[model samples]
Target: MASSSVAGEPKQSRPGFFKRSVQFFKDAWGELKRVRWPNRKELTSYTMVVMGTCIFIILLIFGFDLGISYVLELIGLR
Candidate 1:
């Protein structure tokens, strides 16, 4: 009678936060397994594009820095 509810029997133990988190990771792994990963050639090409863009931006910033420095030096600010 104490374990029984007004409607029926005892309520089963629901999964706690940690157990739910583990289940979520398991489900995520299953989904990740179905993914079509990029090939090495595509990865290398994308990497090279990123590298080239970074190099170009760096050179541009350095050129601007040098120009500003020269102007400041001319004005005896340096």
Candidate 2:
């Protein structure tokens, strides 16, 4: 008995490393081209929002750490 391929077409082998790498970059560039990049004003606004959130989180964590340290000192744990 012999195995039969679909539609009488032979299976194709995978491309080599260099060919695959080149194809990957081509696909990536195509996707990047389709992206909606932010303008300068939007970029600045986004940056400021991120910075403000980070500062708020940093202050929150700092406050928690100070409160914990104070309690530990009162109990002579540190």
Candidate 3:
């Protein structure tokens, strides 16, 4: 039977923690460079849209709660 490892050959070793950490940062920086970041104007527009949607949802929920409470109070449940 033949063996995979030769009698006197040195086996390959895995990368150490320091080398792996450096490689991780290198990969992260490469990905960041490829990203198409939004400009200031676009960021502002997006922020406004998110804020408006949140405010609308809050108001809708508040209206529902008030209506439910009013009905409950009238029926002596509150």
Candidate 4:
């Protein structure tokens, strides 16, 4: 069950497993070369933004937890 080339050349009869691994890596590496990687300043800014957002969410969750605990304690729910 092998494929033939357009010129009637019998395709390489390699095993049916992972047919295009090398091709996939080559294509991926090519794409990686095309990427415009972020500069240090941009990376720092992005990281800071992400950190600030995480801190805000954590603070919000902490406040909610404290409020719920206080209410539960007042009702003798431990």
Highest lDDT: give the candidate number: 3
Alpha-carbon error at 42 in model 4, in Å? 0.5
Question: Of the pair 1 and 3, which is ahead by lDDT?
Answer: 3
* Predicted candidate 3 versus true structure: per-residue lDDT over 8-59, tens digit per residue: 8987788999999999999999999999999999999999999999999999
- Rank candidates, TM-score, best first: 2, 4, 3, 1
Q: Which ten residues in a row have the lowest lDDT in candidate 1?
A: 1-10
C-alpha lDDT score of every prediction, in listed order: 0.94, 0.96, 0.97, 0.90
Please state the error at residue 63 of candidate 4 in Å: 0.9
| Best-performing candidate as measured by TM-score | 2
Candidate 2, pairs of clashing residues: none
Compared with the true structure, the alpha-carbon lDDT of candidate 3 equals 0.97
Root-mean-square deviation (CA) per prediction: 6.2, 3.6, 5.5, 5.7
RMSD over all Cα atoms, model 4: 5.7
The alpha-carbon deviation from the true structure for residue 75 of candidate 1, after best TM-score superposition, in angstroms, is 1.5
Per-residue lDDT of 11 in model 2:
77
**Candidate 4: misplaced stretches above 4 Å?**
1-15
> Model 4, residue 31: displacement in angstroms?
1.5
Expressed as tens digits, the lDDT of each residue in 1-78 for candidate 1 is 455555665677889999999999999999999999889999999999999999999999999999999999999999
| Model 2 vs truth, CA RMSD | 3.6
Q: 60 in model 4: Cα distance from truth in Å?
A: 1.0
